[model samples]
Target: MKKSVFLACLVCFVSVLQAQNFPILGKVVDSTSGQALSKASVFCQNTTFGTITNNEGLFYMNLPNGGYDLVISYTGYEKKLLRISNTQPQKDTLLFVLAPQDNSMAEVAVVASNEVADGWNKYGKFFSDNFIGTTPNAAHCTILNPEALRFFYTKKRNRLRVTAKEDITIINNALGYSIRYQLDSFSYDYNTKISQFTGYPLFEEMDTTEDVKKTWVSNRAKTYLGSRLHFMRSMYDSIITDEGFTVEKMNDDPKSTKGSNIENLYDSSFYFVDSSGVSVGWDGRYRIGYRKVLPDKKFLQEFRLPANASVQVTLLDIADGFVIEQNGYFYEQYDVINSGYWAWKKLAELLPYNYEYE
Candidate 1:
């Protein structure tokens, strides 16, 4: 059987906005021997905030007051993820014990093929487009190690599956961050034209000058707005209109005889939260439309979608109500499936879990 290990280290700190900045302290060591593992990469997933473990296998990072999915990675060991909550009180130095990877698991090949090389050669561009996204910032993102990637195509399903032999390093020059991603699963269905990848990423801020820092700050804010995170926050706050979102719920129940009139089905009565009060945990579908249209020249040229067009999107299989904490941390109870405009936004548009509006 394939063996995978998981460990978590949660550290909550108040942000500068709250008048105090706290440091998250932790140590990484071997599970069996309790030996320190130095040079381990530690960071909040998707955010450009992280630091490496020192010689003592210790690390300290200052994170803003919010919830984050912290990731710790090292060579020859299984990656670990910790969900840190800002609401929790700061604790003593957290200890993470990592188990060694079983060598036998590496020897077993899930997909045997020489087609791996040919696949990357044939579908490299398509993979990059869907994975890194077509956003303006995507142009600055480069996959540093593409050779470690392996691919397999399923004819019946018309889907592509990809895996990596090791961690994939991506340099986001536009965002001034280096992302080290350990890909667990990846697939793209040709029939649906939808792609998805599950992985753990550790983001490291790139060394930059003061001027470039300003650019990143501006760019990050731009990317944050109109994002899924922003939408969720707006929904939780009951301020959809203020956030430029026109959310209308759709009846997905096949048994419900709501008639064939699509326009009538889009009535505001079906809104996620109406006079019935906010839906605590809705397990249904909804149409999320954004009025903010992208007018950036780079976006227009890259996507080639009509100029100044409204962004209309649909989300399916949402199993729960949009729940958000005071610190802008969204719980992952809703397994939302994004389609249309939002579907195109990928890692390139992803903000850190701890990201908060200024």
Candidate 2:
């Protein structure tokens, strides 16, 4: 099997209020026939905001003012994604034009490869470990629609690829959320021990008992603290130190592990905050250290580090920099590569973009 693909995605902006909620209208239509596509799924990626198009192909959603990737999907059609920066009330209806999917080409390109008939049984654990994650929260997570998955292995490349026939359902009992994931692609390289997956996931808070809800609240708060999401939000609010995070510039040499303390995270040289948002164009790698929470035991063991490891640290490489909004959303997301602890925090630990710690 010869299979490969890649993707990049999100954005940010803010004003007086971090993000003001406003109504947005949109329509979806077939590009070839110019006909309205009814019942099409329209959503803002990584957020709970979503709606289905009506008979006339119209839909509306009230999204907080910020940057988002508007996702449009319908059966047997090529999915469309639009980067939207909604800072003001939209007066005009947004439009989405999608083309029919080439199932034949996609099949020949991806499916016709050396597919494993018992893929789920063979690679199910591997896939789930990498996709849903291996965090403590992930232990209680279940892939509700495992049957939708199709796995392929390319012997030549020592790579495994997984795709889904439809949205994959995931129930995160630990976080008390149900996730509908539109899986575009998931690939893993055995040689590099690298796994990458791309998709638009819509999160919905699950109904539960009051006791469970309280437990979920506590869990979410613990997960959010010292997280990359927390760091980004602190950066936007110009409260890095207040949030108990420290920034350091990594040594120039790739082999060197030493770094220098970044006394001023909001220094004009690498960062700035304004009414619009925060702009950070850090030239080199940054080491973010958070002592508010200790490193996960699994992370400590996985890295073969001492049990005394205190700080939860992450390494970041920014390509040409990126901008962040008050909601902790960032843009040129592809340019920001995460390593270390942050890389280990996958979907199971992810919170909705609209998540508010307070």
lDDT of each: 0.71, 0.87
Cα lDDT of model 1 by residue, 1-358, tens digit: 1232222111222223443445689999998899999999898775667788999999998776556778888888878888776556778898889998776755564534324557778888888998888778898899998998988887877889888888899888887778888798889999987788898777776888999988988888888777777876676576767787765556777455232223442235433443222334645666676666454555555668676665645354576544455445555732666665566678887776656566
In terms of lDDT, the best-performing candidate is 2
TM-scores of the candidates in the order shown: 0.75, 0.92
Candidate 2 residues lying further than 4 Å off, grouped into runs, are 1-19, 88-91
Model 2 RMSD in Å is 10.2
* Maximum-TM-score candidate: 2
Per-model tally of clashing residue pairs: 2, 0
1-358, model 2: which lDDT tens digit per residue?
1232222111233333335766678889999998999999999888888889999999988777667888999999999998776653456898889999887877678655989999999999999999988899989899998999999999999999999999999999998889999998999999999999899999999998999999999898988999888888888888898889998899988778899998777779878776567899786788999988899999898889999999998999877888898678888888989899989989999998888775
TM-score of 1: 0.75
